[model samples]
Target chain A: MGGGITLEHFLVLGLILFLLGAYCVLTRRNAIGILLGIELMLNAANINYLAFAFFGGARYDGQIFAIFVIMLAAAEAVIGLAVILAIYQNLRTIDVDATETLSG
Target chain B: MLNSLAAQAIFYVIAALTVGFAALVAFSRNIVYSAFALVGALMGVAGVYILLAADFVAMVQVLLYVGGIVVLTIFAVMLTQGIGDLAVSNRAVGPGAGLAVVALAGAVMLYATLRTPWHLATAVAVASTTYGIGNAFLGVYVLPFEIASLVLLAALVGAVTISRQDTPPPADGAAEKGRS
Candidate 1:
């Protein structure tokens, strides 16, 4: 471990993670998988906040927003899961492809 | 040279893990595996935060994302299905276009970075991320915090109402015949 690190390292890592999350969002069929993708996307934003805070002048402001993002993610998970449960109750299957019942 | 060597090694390890786990989460077909991959990716992100001297935010990343959100996702996957879906893995989307777009975007960023002359003074970047975060929690961010709490409250109530299924009463009035 180094005594200290630099900004480039953090930025590169954030980029890679953000791309991965984006890929997941584009391809996942499971509603929960989509939610996980959203989680990654939000996390990528969090990384940006921390990086800006450390390297730029946006310190506390970034962390506070990141904290709110995390809280919002948790809330999203709860509501998403509830919605998923309701879908399961109606269709008996969790596949997103199968939820074409309301295509009209 | 030695100082940079250490930074380079730590950077590679954490960066590799973050990218690898994120790719896994994005590509893995089994929903549960994706959730688990999210845990790994989230931890790597926390590591990156720590590297940036944002120790408090890093801990929060571990606590809320890796610990809470990922675990919640796993429990949800378990609740909805049997063990069969665990084996049911398949690629659902074509990632080539997305990959191309990301690569192009990365190239643009790189070009922009190279085009600009960055400040190189040894600015003592002491990341007091926690102090700032604390101030926000008690200051301008209080309204958003309260609103988030309300959203959580609504989610809990909504979940309870949706999950609890009340039994329907006998439509033919079997209770009356039984009483007679």
Candidate 2:
């Protein structure tokens, strides 16, 4: 069980995921794109949790935490999209540049 | 050496596809394409989880993110078709190099954290861990779980309310029971 795949492999994957997610969030201006970025970041953390759970030879606390993270991400997306719709209804756009009336 | 060779081959394939698709998602101008690329990246991660032997989590990843979230995003993209079509600023990706730098720094930090010393529990502890997770979810984390469900309920209500007023049911929405 502990012969081939190791914790290090999981950790590196999680790191790459984290970086990709951060780049997505920072660069995208569209509301949904931003939301996807956030989802990616959340999933990166979740991956880490699962990897550690299985490979760090720990109790399933990490897995439990990952499950919670997934649930929370779903809830967040729903709420975020709703908010985006509300904003779009009033302003008719999702560009962060255009919706900066209150950015002060 | 043979085991690592096999693993490396698989990892290289997944890593290339995952990073490439993820970059497309971040760089693509079209919102729908970005969503599609995100789905691709997510599916890749799920595959990695499978390779890591976390079968349950991998399935959940595919089901929740790819099936549920990606589908919902596509529906949203279809709904907002008119909005996304308008010409966006060509310079949306300004200072792309700076953002890349930040991402690189974050990547390094995360790698360092992962490499830092962490205690590893014994296999006996790992053996009952799955059951422990279940009991912990119910026993210790129940309150948060219940609260999260309520939040989801609220989101459902909010989604209905938002998508209702501006656009009435046009058969696309299919909210017609007796309205037609």
Candidate 3:
């Protein structure tokens, strides 16, 4: 309170978000759920990047990197959802647990 | 100062919105709920970007992540049938193990975050970053910028290719028999 908001505050917040995202990825059976988790994790990383950029000199590098991450995330979501739709077309279910053809 | 206090309050509110909705996204039983909760979590992150003075990134977050990705997720959730069964649709596996892993990772990350001696400098004065970002994208980051556009084009084409339904079999008895 005395120092107002510190870097640690943002760092801790990002950490919590990352952990929750990890939990989501680890526990969820649906592929889309896992994708949701991934989005959260990516955002958590972006938070850390912006936080550092803000506190470490306010350079544009971190912001640029965050934008790239967001772009890649958009790509990933499109590809991932398309794959899920493909799986659904063939198997009729989007359950991650059910799609184990590669497990063999 | 009163200004700092107000900033702190705003930060707290943004943090609460982010973490609370993230929790809902992680733990909600319905995939639809999780997808929708992600909207809140993402918006909260955009707020955090604003708080960090990244106006351009914040707007991009709203435009891309919230506007595009969340809607795409919701559409995916609806397209897949059997969404009404809340119990099995978004079932979680090994919650006990997941909790253990999260705790371990959280503890490690928290310890590292608290113990690290971060080199901090006085933050730059808040200003419009759109100009600086545009310049950087065209100048020092030009190569990567081009590469990103390539990636997006590839992804766009790949998504269409992958999701396109197989051409309906020719409306012929022989074609229908072969498809079956």
Candidate 4:
């Protein structure tokens, strides 16, 4: 803990965040809750990308990919929320389990 | 030496903020609380980006992720009803199974991460990444940049099309019967 921050430290932090996100996604019944978990997972990945970029000769590629990921995440959030709204309109609930009409 | 120590302290604080709020987001019983807690988690990630010398990406993370997505999620939560029923509304299903799955995945990922012999580069002086990033986006990464814009446009149209109330909701029973 006294030593300066290292790549492993960032990697471990990301691992914890990713695992928490996985747990959130696996357990949450609410659709928005699942989306929130996905966001956390994506952030964890972004942290890894920036960490590698900083350490790997400080190239711009990692940051660029991170920007793209953020862009895609925004698109995903928009579409997902819209779908959730649509589901709520029809079923009056945003529970993932309750919207399992396609399971048949 | 003192400077590095201070940096380490700051890193620990930011790490705590990030992991702590993330835990809240994942485990909070109230859906609204989960949504709000996401702001803290995301902000802490931005702090992480800054620490990693990614100023532009950090700002973008703050702007897009914090300003855009979390607010949209909160809106979605408020728009839907039954939000007051905190106990059951944000219920967890199959906690034991979820824990088992996460633990297994965490173990594999942590093992790989720790065991890898990474090729490390000497630390370079921190510089503004905005100029280089802008050039790469316009020059080498132009195609992907254009494609991203197209994707955003498509998302805009699709969201409006899907969520608009003018269209009638699909007949659930009929759809299920048809599918079967």
Chain A TM-score for each candidate, in the given order?
Answer: 0.88, 0.91, 0.95, 0.95
lDDT of 3 by residue, B137-167 (tens): 9999999999999999999999999998784
Model 1 chain B scores worst on lDDT over the 10 consecutive residues at B82-91
Top candidate by DockQ: 3
TM-score of chain B of each: 0.69, 0.70, 0.88, 0.87
DockQ of 3: 0.70
lDDT of 3: 0.91
Q: How displaced is residue B105 in candidate 1, in Å?
A: 5.4
Model 4 spans with C-alpha error above 4 angstroms: B1-3, B84-93, B167-180
| Residue runs of model 2 more than 4 Å from their true location after superposition | A1-5, B1-8, B82-93, B100-104, B107-111, B122-133, B161-180
Give residue B55's lDDT in candidate 1 (0 to 100): 82
Clashing pairs in 2: none
Task: Report per-prediction Cα RMSD to one decimal.
Answer: 5.1, 4.6, 3.3, 5.7
Give the Å error, residue B176, model 2: 12
Docking class of 4: medium
Q: Estimate the lDDT of model 2.
A: 0.70
CA-lDDT, candidates in order: 0.72, 0.70, 0.91, 0.90
TM-scores of the models, in the order given:
0.80, 0.79, 0.92, 0.91
Predicted candidate 4 versus true structure: per-residue lDDT over B98-148, tens digit per residue: 889899999999999999997778788888999999999999999999999
Query: Comparing candidate 2 with candidate 4, which one achieves the higher lDDT?
Result: 4
- Per-residue C-alpha lDDT of model 1 across residues B1-180, encoded as one tens digit per residue: 214767668877987888888888877756777778888888988887777667887888889888888888888888887424542322544466666766777777656644655433344466456676777787887888788888889888987787654445457977745432
lDDT of 1 by residue, A1-104 (tens): 24555555565566666666766666656778778888888888788777766566556776777777888888788788878877877777777777888888
Query: Would candidate 1 be rated incorrect, acceptable, medium or high by CAPRI criteria?
Result: medium
List, for all models, the DockQ compared with the true complex.
0.50, 0.42, 0.70, 0.64
